[model samples]
Target: MDGTHLFELVIAMFLAIIALHYLAHRLGLPPSVALLTGGAALAFVPGLPAIEVDPELVLVIFLPPLLFDGAWSIAVDRLKRHMFGIASLAVGAVFFTTVVVAVVTHVLMPSLPWAGCAALGAIVSPPDAVSARAILERVNLPRRLQILLEGESLLNDASGLVLFRFAVAAATTGAFSATNAAGTFILLAAGGAIVGCVVGYAWVKLVRKLHDDYLMIAATTLMCWIAYLLGEQLHVSGVIATVTAGLIASWYQHTVMSAATRMRGTSFWTVLVFLMEAMVFILIGLSLRDIVERGGGFGALLETMALPALAILVTIVVARFVWIFASDVAIELAHRTGLARSVPMGTGAATVLSWAGVRGVVTLALALSLPDAFPGRDFILVIAFAVIMGTVLLQGTTLGAVISWAGLRGTEAEGAPMTMSQAEAAMAQVQFAKVKSLAFDTDGNLIHPQLLRRYEHRATAIIDYAQRTEDYVPMLHAHFDVVLEAVAVGRTELIRLRRAGQIDDETLRELERDLDLEELSAISAKA
Candidate 1:
């Protein structure tokens, strides 16, 4: 495709993805899933010419910002707590999954080379953060479970990508070397880390010097994509660099950024990540035909796809169960040894985390990026696609079922009532603080005397309302025998009149809103 045609296709893709994503979100489904499904449909539709997706575009343009956003949003405290689990899952589990998938694929499909199988396995092993974040963040996984899953997902991309490089090299050269591969992996990982930190630090310093919110936001955004490109150019892991940069930059969020800069950067990054995530998934769905066509005939493709998908699905399920059980045992040992305090991993939390592991774009990108001349590339592509679809569709759809079966739903009660007195007191404090902040100048001199006096009067009324909150609980129980009984009575009379069609719709709606406020007050006071 030429520049103009490619540009138009990009616009069309973005618009379609955005519209579909909005619909999915409105319908209470994850926008990522919607995008993936949409992408698949777009690819399969007749009369649509094949869409050319550049692998370089994905690694350079897509991966970095996505990884950075994930790293940025994950809190340091949460990341630290789940550090062991994340490390184990990201570094260890991926390798284990890759090895297992490779061995199984080689044994099952003897015609496919070991190296090719390994490449496909590595691509499929790491769950996508985009998918995990979309699913897990919205669900009621315990704080700890959410952290563990997110941390693992965040770091595993680097691990998978690194392994992918090795796998590709092996497949292309028809050779494999343990020693050299291990050494290269370590060097690249370390080099990527160094580059990320140095670049991130420099970027933050530049942003701080500029002190322009728009410019800062733009620079940070550019850094995400730039880090990926630079890392790839250096032949280090781009995903690693992106994640590392995000972490380093996030560490300096408050220290380096002006308040306005921080606010605008945060908003801009959040929106950008959301849009990219939606687009990636949609593109994944749309590429179904690309995978199928590239893999050969549908009948032949299905035969190749079925075994690998089943193997991946089974392997993931079994592996997760073993990992979780072992991790739990380790957690117990740590508590016993006084290395950590015992924090219960509720059944719901554990189950949800296991089920939330959905494969996504990273796998598809790896599949598509495989060299055309690579032996058994078509088979590998089919298997990888199968794994992605099976894990995401089957596992994602049934995760909630597993959660319910395991009784993993949140224990926290929804919208629990609070006593009126407590609510009134809290609201009073907020009102008083706002008033005080407005009344006083930075030098401690009073400003706007007339407005200050009026504020003082309103503040006193808030204080009085706050005090009445203590009696609110009893008053509500006694049907308004204490504090503002007459006011409540008048409001009830107004509500009844409105209900009887004695007031206009707007007046009735206004009265209903007031009634809601009063009810909230009473409920708060009771709590």
Candidate 2:
């Protein structure tokens, strides 16, 4: 397409996304589902150009940032606590789903090569992290459960992509070996992680030397792309590399970068992720036109492939449910026998987790990446698309209701208590003391007795509120709102002063940044 048409297409997609996103929010549906539906509908509209989605662009441009941001936001402590569950789902369950999908597809389509079937299996196995997290945002779930879901989504793409590469190689070359593939998987995962950490450490050091928010943000963006590209060039898993780098960078950022940089970086990444996700889902829906046209239109394609697509969708859902239940049962048994320390995984949690498997962008991208000469490529694409649409539409829509029905709509009782970190409490105490000291003269005699008394009272209140108990939660929230309001007012005044020429732009910005940092801290405390 020429530049004019391309610009028009981009504008149309954005307009559609904005409209559908608003509608989705109002209707209590996942925005992704709404976007997908809208894009698909647009495909049949006359006078509208077909939007071609390049699989390579999606993988290279979209995947890294999305994966990195998600990984970066994940709490390291939560990952450690739910490591077992996350692994069970990310690695073990992904492989299991691949095998089940391969076996089922092979049985249903005997003429299709086993290798090709395996490739298809790997393509569709890993549920999309973006979709799962997006849907879960609307549903209340236990913290540990949420952690497990998010962690699995973050990690499984690497495993799935690794399996996909091997399957494709085997199919294309007519060669397959389980032992060799296993070794390759280990190398890709471990090597990619090592590369990510080394790169992440270097990137963090570089960022520490930079003071400009724009430069810091630009450098972090480059890090995601560079990490993925470097890992791929080294013949390892780019997904793992990007994920690892994001996690390391996130964990060390506070120590290395200013609070201003962190706050601005967070906002930058949030907008980037939102836009990327919006385009990905809409592009996914738009790509259906190509599939439909290739299969000789929608009706003809459905007539030929509907049953197989339905079967594949059912198989994917069932496999996830089985694996989740079995893992929970094994964990329970282990805990009872004192063989291991495991949190009690109730039926409600298990059910919710099982139903939360919604395939998304990764599946579509990988399916589209299949070589033209690959056996039954069109068929594979159709089935993959069907599974993605079916799971995301059916499961995504009902997940909240399912959670409600299962009675899994609260934070887990057995998980870590919700309390301020000791480090945070200490920092608050220090700040309070500093402020109180400012209310006194250099010799420590109170210059403003009322101010000294007020600071002391607030400090005590904060200290008491920081204690781990349910009773102080409301008081803590009230304190946070008050602090946030004060910071917000300070920011407004700084902006006004700059506009009125009472303060220079530089001074206004510096003071405004301080208030922004304070605001972020207060908001974080409330969360």
| Top candidate (lDDT) | 2
Instruction: Report how far residue 111 has shifted in candidate 2, in Å.
Output: 0.9
Q: What is the lDDT of residue 468 in candidate 2?
A: 52
Clashing pairs in 2: none
- Worst lDDT window (10 residues) for model 1? 411-420
TM-score of each: 0.77, 0.89
* Model 2: ten consecutive residues of lowest lDDT: 411-420
Alpha-carbon local distance difference test for all models: 0.75, 0.86
Runs in model 2 lying further than 4 Å from the true structure? 412-418, 421-426, 432-454, 466-527
Tens digit of lDDT per residue, candidate 2, span 295-403? Answer: 9997898799999999999999999999999988888899999998985678888999999999988999899999989998999999999998999899988888898
Candidate 1, 362-472: lDDT as tens digits:
888888888888777777777777777777777766776777787665433223364444465567667767877888788989887777677667667656756675554
Which parts of model 1 are misplaced by more than 4 Å? 172-180, 337-347, 409-527
